[model samples]
Target: MAPMAEPVAAAPAPPHFVIVPLPAQGHTIPMADLARLLAERGARASLVVTPVNAARLRGVAGLAARAKLRLEIVEVPFPADSGLPPGVENVDQITDYGHFLPFFLALKELAGPLEAYLRAQAVRPSCVISDWSNSWTAGVARRVGIPRLFFHGPSCFYSLCDINAATHGLQQQDDTERYLVPGMPVRVEVTMGTRPGFLNSAGFEALKDAAMEAMRTADGAVVNTFTDLEDEFIACYEVALGKPVWTLGPFCLCNRDDDAMASRGNKLGIDQSAVTAWLDAMDTDSVIYVNFGSLARKVPKYLYEVGHGLEDSGKPFVWVVKESEVSTPEVQEWLSALEARAAGRGLVVRGWAPQLAILSHRAVGGFVTHCGWNSLLESVAHGVPVVTWPHFSDQFLNERLAVDVLGVGVPIGVTAPVLLFGDEAMRFGRADVARAVSALMDGGEEADERRRRAKVYGEKARRAMEKGGSSYESLTQLIQSFTLQGGKQH
Candidate 1:
């Protein structure tokens, strides 16, 4: 008999990724989700996070274990030179506004070790997916002969807004004047008063230059938004940046499972079951879910006005309040009064709520949000109409997308430019709040139309995440591109 053919050698694994995320809750969540998506597509993924961030990501590690995916978490010590306090690994921990520079500088200091770690890996990563803010990683990837892709967590529309502003020259625009973005499918207005402070800051200019240079020279960009949601903006961004763009998100939707949902729900320290039970008792589309995100510091007076407004609306609502924000006697008193006035129709959770779980629930009809990208996507994914209250960077632009481009949101009178550090001095009276809530939750022809549009968009978002959908196709193309030639930039 002919000698048995030697066992065929196993083919090598597909492209392995080294994902470096900015150490913040918003950045961390989507970065982790991207890693999971990569693993699902048969790529090995290693997420690099600071030690403190590593601890916060334990839940994700548990998630990977349960799913039995090829994902690993690599701890890279946050630089000692960052001058940050012992336990402060994230931007949110730098309570004092003065520490912002040091935090920015500290992020840069991680580059050396990151390069060293990449060089030492047994199977070198074929691609590096780093936060766009982490501009130094581009050079590191170059040194190691691998392609690097920048990841931006905000909407493509917001990016286009920034690009347009930079192109038109920030010096040419007056602080109070509105200007149209150059390449958008629809006209969107922006003013200096509405732009983020970092856009003009001398120090931020340096970082922005470095990031833009890296982005221009890097392989491509991977944004946490989908094509159907921002097709025009995505195309414009690609033309402006001169690189291939991958829109593989609504990343939150990609990883929605009972276990993943439960794990995320617990992170906010909320009892998921308890929250669901409360929703169970409410009528369909009766409750408005309110959360201003973890970072937006609510002004006490504004918080008080919100309390009175919710009370005036007389509608059932669930408000997610950060425990730290309301710890003061004055805010606590306002919260207590608000609760008393609501007469058992309102529930104020003083910790993290299961945001996705809450949004997906049938009881939640409207979202009163700060217009953060993640919250905006969640609102759209769940078919919940929004009352937009944009108070910071990229939020105002996102609000325009929801209210104008998408036609699924109502504005709540917050239009001033918000500085990065200071609170917005604008106050919404109780009447303003009540009116917005009533228009969203109560019956009205316009509100019904907005809700109908919102539901249609939500169905589109869901379809985009399924096999053969736009988002799924984008992910597949991204993976295939990486495997075949590492990466290609226009």
Candidate 2:
């Protein structure tokens, strides 16, 4: 009944570009920032998203709209491994380890569906900006003659250190905690860098390998951290990757004010308002805001130790405790015990907060974080000193940069196996955790000096992201490169 066959017209050039991310808030945010940059250079954006992440893509889409950019969304299905609870369509629902393994696999599995969608788009994209999970897209791009852009939503320094460690084996060896990497600038890539009182644990070897593979296949890479935050390191990174590494972020630059939409996308009714109110009530340098960051797990003992440490320090504090992290009745009750004792002085948040905003608030003096690269940048960007508890990956190096190099934060906790199980490990449980907390809370005169220095760090971060700054210039150059036809390097 259908008149089927017709002569096909010559295909026009592909659409502007398609960005495929790992479908997490961390990955989505940076890609959205890049999409805005692409649009500014007059390139249309086709953001390929999985069904679970579609709402988030739409939420970020609102930001592009404000810039008068027409950003399109194309959907792909999550791999069965994602373990989306029976009928749950949203990526936000899978919060625990029960889903993490599967979700990680799903992110990688999404390559095929995304490739199919890219092939059928109205206009072909010049290149593909693929996130960590979708690194497989690089192969697809090569198959179809488009460039592959691997996105690393963290500091260039972190990536540099990770690759360095993989090459030099920075993991703890027979209780020798720190290791020196052969790269220039006399670099040290400790298993968990302990400059003095601080102990950091950097794990997740599986992920480092995956990232290196992705980078190997891609034409270029993008790191969502400013050049100033990791100057010499990004240069080292250019050598490590054997390609150009563009330093673009703290990618929340183009983020919109649509809290409801962002909350929907993030799937946590993150009561950012309450956080601000708590900050408002505190005196300057009075409150130490504690957040383990999104991916950092709170082992019950560590959580309890943190609570007791805050209480013993006698500092005014607001600890953002997520119900999801506790995940059990016993842990919830234990948390309540801490809550009841410290009722008036401390507030525990039920969900997430606008972290950078909270960190920047006048009343907030210090931050306790998991040392995710984004969290590191936020602390530096806001001039909020840190009590770093690095859980995994390049976070250890970030902690090194924070305390050893910049003097912006102090480190606590050792999660390496020997450190956790050895003779000194039990001591680590008590001494290291409490000491780091106290240093940041300093009742000493040095607190004022630290605060002044922190403010300077924040100002520098602002300048870097502003128009005509190094980060801005890097972004502009990156956009120009992508915008050229024939995909020529020159």
Candidate 3:
């Protein structure tokens, strides 16, 4: 009787993930959001970043505490000898594009320290979730005998279009030649020059090749997109990538709470309250919202011409100008003049902006965006039409998703894809910007149709994130799969 029964052993906890996103905002934000999503679904999570980035993400600890989620912030010192300026650990910090090569070199040095850190963790990481830029993580994951999942921070449509463009030999076409992306759900046009450099340049090819090779060798991909929005594209992406691809995305929707968002501080320093108040004062669907994301650096002339375009649109607007790019006194003077001329019709946010809040507001009629995946998803989620101004990388392809696949946008005439630090073949003038903005917001059959399609898509996006939705189910499956693998390890 005294030795009746021994206490049953407790079941082990789920997998612990070590997320290593590229230091860029576009990559970091989505990765962070994914971590939050995993934690919400009952998995242990940790994010590794440079000490500088860790400080930026300190608020996350408080966020997790409030949500009662499991998350830890692990910091590794950035290589001090790496030639980059002190505290300059991100791509956005390289004011001169000439330093990009050196910047990449510095990023490569992070792998060693990160690997050592993971090995020393008490609960070994079951997987290494890394951005496409961190190709070296594949090796690290292999060394540690863990799975690696590549993260693509863009739409499935954009990724598939790029894959199809390569498959159809569109990569060889001239700069301005428009060719249909093969095997797409709808007709989308792209030019050879609009493709990312890894496709053409000898030096940059190494990075692309490494990323693709890593994906081929890894467990699978975790794309930042959902099925309902790009069902056809998702199918095509799976076939092209030849791996099990999961379309659990619009990670922005994962954190519906205000506290979660506040945790990711606005790096741009814009006044959130004032911007919202101004937007609140505008009529529904009357004001256009403008932003080029964190990394885009528009030349002074381009900035001035865009200002003129905003003025000429005769529509209420809010524009975010990157602080680093608009440093000169002349540009500042131009911005001051633009704000003064608006006479309360516009708001110019110079530093940081709460982009999600702005997009969801009823007053935001259209988005003039650089076509970053996050911005594109936000615009689509809010059902706001777009005036696409693609700058680099996958942006041009994302523009096609809006203007071509979704029919919810008009291009601002960026025909040739501009490379990082490459010479501009054509400068965007005021006329082009004004016309694109007008086409999106001005009353007309075309604009109305675009608005209708956008609202419908937006509704669908919202539904996909709800309970029992496509994205919701996909996320559950993702966690379960990894958790099982983690259990096997122990």
> Per-residue lDDT tens digits of candidate 3, residues 1-490?
5777888977667788889988888888888888888888888888989887787787776788777888887888888888877778877677775566667667788889988988887767878888877888988888888888888888887777766665675533355566666777776666666763333555567777777677678788898877877888898889888887877778888767545555664454665667778888899999999998887777776778888999998999898887875789988888888889997898888877888878888999999998999989988888999999887778888887888788999888886766553325556788898899999999799999999999998988888888798888988888888777664332
Cα lDDT tens digits for candidate 2, 1-490: 9899998975443237788876666557567667766676566777777665676566566656766775777777766645557634333455444555555555667668876776775445677888755656767887667788888766665666656655665544565765565554645645443321111213434654565677787888888777666688888889887888877775654443545224323544456676677678889877888886655555666667777888877777878776665778888998888889888788777666666566667888888887777777777777888887765555666777777777777767554422221123323554565677788877576655666777887777778777887777887777666655533221
Model 2, runs deviating above 4 Å? 1-15, 40-42, 81-103, 167-177, 192-211, 256-265, 415-434, 443-449, 486-490
Q: By how many angstroms RMSD does model 3 differ from the true structure?
A: 2.5
Candidate 2 structure, TM-score to reference: 0.82
Q: What Cα-based lDDT does every candidate model obtain?
A: 0.81, 0.67, 0.80
**lDDT of candidate 1 over 1-490, digit per residue (tens):** 8989999976655778899998877777788889989988888788998888887778888888888888899999888867777888887676776777778778888888889888887767779999888898988889888888999878988888787666775443455476666666777777766663233555678887888787778888999887778898999989888888899877888657656766542266667888889899999999998888767766666677777788788889998877767878988887887777775699888877888888999999999998988889989988999999888778898999999898999999887855444455675688999999998888789999999999988888888888998888998988887776642321
For candidate 1, list the clashing residue pairs, or say none: 193-417
Per-candidate alpha-carbon RMSD to the true structure: 3.0, 7.3, 2.5
- As a whole number from 0 to 100, the lDDT of residue 309 in candidate 1 is 85
Best lDDT among the predictions, by candidate number: 1
Model 3 worst lDDT window (10 residues): 195-204
Query: Whose lDDT is higher: candidate 1's or candidate 3's?
Result: 1
TM-score of each: 0.94, 0.82, 0.93
Cand. 1 TM to true fold: 0.94
Candidate 3: deviation at residue 182, Å?
4.3
